[model samples]
Target: MKNVETNKKIIQKKQVKIYYLSPEYVYYPIYNNNPKFFVKSKSNVFKETLLFEDNNTKNYSNISGQVMGMKNISGKNYLVLKNDFHEKYSAPKSFRRKVNKLTKKEILDILNENDAASYSSDIKYFINNFESIDSLILNLLICEDSDKIYSEVFNKYNSDILEMFDAISQIFEISNPVIMLSDTDDKNIEFVTNLSGMYPDIRIVLSHDKYPASHPLLITRKLNLSNALVLSSMDLYYLYSIVKRNKKVSEKMILISGDALNSDFIVETKLNVLISDIISLCKIKLTEDDVLCKNSAIRAEVVSIDDTIDTTVDAIIIAKKGNNNPKECINCGLCNKNCPQKINPQMYKLNNLPFPGKCINCNMCSYVCPRMIRKDI
Candidate 1:
């Protein structure tokens, strides 16, 4: 390979890589009830079998396996099962629908019928509350540099994603529907640019590859919209899968990346896949010095490797132990300047003021910290 100078600002597009995990076991976390709901301690389960239903959310088994009763993982109870390596589904596959012609109520019906939509999801909240949206934006880059779940999905399904976006705009009667991609994503930019003539309602806007810009509050300011329904790429993908692909929701995307690992990549695996299974399938090792964090590296909850990927987790970061001791604040103004909500984090850091109500709880202050002083503000 010849040495070539490249621009540091622009991130060249890489081939879309997806790692699949053939799990020997799938752990279904129990939420509302005990695992011993049936008469037998062991039973066979098909794919998409109803595990349990609670709080208006139905849980399903992601694989066909032999149930082995309850197993506790990291203090949480999960109904474990041994996989038979057979992907037998309880229900037959659905036929694809002409989603573009669907009414708003019909679309909502589809979301409600499927397991992908939830009562507490951000997308569902916005959709149910709005009569009409001003700007419908899909946020592909959500402030995490190593989290490539969104962008990688976009890379693999750019054309279909654009079609779905257009259909959503038409169905919602949104006057302005935009998608925010990283400015350095030239491959996606060119791909969408060539197809821009087909979908006039869909506008592709490049977002800054910097912190705080992808925040909902700052995104509205950047797009100059009164009110917007901003969704993550995964959020829209769930809807897309329900409408465009007409497939029952089974697999979920997760990004496993950190300095402790050899490289960064995304994994497309079944829902509720165990973190330990992901690590083992990917051949990842956790040394004594390395720590595992859920969703974020510095400003996230520390998790054990046995944790299962529930609805809340999007990324698992395995980080090497470094100097995490908080240093004295040097009166730097980065926290104040980078705050998307305009509430000064410096006052709270110094114990001069309590945590303000206006704080959006973004990690901008810690992300911009030079001395790693403010890890959570």
Candidate 2:
């Protein structure tokens, strides 16, 4: 126990690369041991940074902020917007007003009406595209009551995970797969394990951690994983499933959250819903005359929802100000001081440190900044 604690302290002292892995396969990998040191490869790292920066709209080499991923497929491209994924958006009033008893059809219709595609298509696509396989390993945080969504299939297979496995086994000749429970709560893990055990041959492993252990690919690689299917949260999966069901299911789940909006409510919305519609759902109280946001402050570009009206669109961000480029160092050494490991932040920016593979990407520097400067890590 002492040795374990000592090792943890040492590992925490430096930067680390954390990733999330999917458990849709039979065998997955785990690092032999926690990674100790990071190799900084500037050319490789910078190239990767540029690849993910959405587009070359901003010059990143000269900037100290982190790069973000933003790619729009709506025929028109825009700058990457920094919005909260976990943060909720406002529920549509009509949808909320009628929330007395939402049937599956009403829910699907509401999402369809708002132009936000449901998860129906994506799920069907997974079922269709992949060769009929007998095994399934879902990441727990991503699973919702799919039995509720796919009533017909759930009804046929009983939607009980074990039943689903049994049905799958009948369809494809393969061994039963194990479900990895990412939750540390002993109760949740045991519940899933018990439920899974109902199947003839199924195994379960419970995991306890806050962030995703690593990207699914890395985890599977470490575990020697070869074949599997992966899934995400309900909303995302819903969208994917809907897309699979119908190609026209192009609606998106626009998540708006953070200190900006005091409320967080996930809503299904259309791919082309106006900014005003989104704000209305978000329950933002800004009047037409009141400045909605600081155009230059947000990572996303600004656009008008209606040319004749003053209201912004669902995709617009109304902040209080713009971001200022860093010119002078505060000399407080906060960036270096707050680093999980004692890495020099100044050196990171100055090109003195060529490789940032060790950086844990905890956003400690961004969190402690006086300027609220955004880093898209």
Candidate 3:
């Protein structure tokens, strides 16, 4: 295997402090524009209730609630729900004790039946091509686009995560399964390192704590990983919840951190709950002038408090708004130099060059700028 380059700088982003938030409301976008719902308007939805499904994944209610009505935002329809706060579980919750005993068909069925797929193609890919996969790589690092790590889950659900991880590898024709963690994450590194001896089949490897280190493509490239099923911590969390805890997919852990607040934190809240609600519930000290970036600070698009969290949304960075006035580009050339894909973002802006065809959206071109002026232009 190729070695992880030591030249990469360590990422200073902090861990998402865990919080359980029960917002009064949550919303779900109408899947494929018009979804065939098992629940209608004013219908009572218990927790773990299946609302919809597609070829890739399934959607389940995270909270017990009454469907209030429909909401339309920017031509998209959302099912608005008022949380009853009871968290009543749907009927027929099943738990599997002997994970290793599960057959290939049974594993696929459980993933589909219990909403383990959870709006991600990662799980769906297993159902279709498990036989062809040569390795299973569990990416315990944060999502590529975000600044927070789900390190807490590795400690909290270590046994279940590893259990499901090993079982999936055993069933899916995977031999050299690897669980990748950020070396800078001392908490997870310590926990997993200590517990790894029990699961001798699974190997624990540390990735450089660097920006874009969480990117799956970069990871595969660096590790020389091919024919590997790379999955995020969220995927495994859903697997553990669905398979072990017998819980439905609803609440998700998201990073709510930035200098705009007194402290940085993460909230495990009902999906599609308003960001404003979470801020208020957590007593986050965000002001009007403070900017909220949906994923990364390098991302130019700002998300307002009115926006709802979708399943795919991983973070809301509350930061004091920076100066929008343009500054003359410094001659440091860091943007061009640091770009992993070697895209000349400066030329795109300074010379009116069309944006390069192979931009990977690493955001390094924007993040490395000393003036913070280069936005992958």
Model 2 TM-score is: 0.39
TM-score of each: 0.86, 0.39, 0.82
Q: On residues 287-343, what C-alpha lDDT tens digit does candidate 3 reach at each position? A: 666888776655545787777776566778765666555468877787777676777
Clash total of candidate 1: 0
lDDT of 2 by residue, 1-377 (tens): 00011112101112111111111111101122332212122222221122222221211121112223323333433222222222222221221322223444543454454334223343444445435533455444311111112221122222333443433333344454655554543544555555654564656655543222323443444345566544333323333233223222223333333224444333344332334555654667654433342111122343443211111112233443334454455666656665654567655654444437766554445444454332342
Question: Candidate 3: what lDDT?
Answer: 0.69
lDDT of 1 by residue, 227-260 (tens): 6888776676677777765555667777777654
Q: Candidate 2, overall lDDT?
A: 0.35
Residue 171's C-alpha lDDT in candidate 3?
78
Ranking by TM-score: 1, 3, 2
Those runs of model 1 whose alpha carbons end farther than 4 Å from true positions after fitting are: 1-18, 32-40, 54-56, 130-132, 245-247, 370-372, 375-377
Alpha carbon lDDT of each predicted model: 0.69, 0.35, 0.69
Clashing residue pairs, candidate 1? none
RMSD of 1: 4.6
Model 3: clashing residue pairs? 62-250
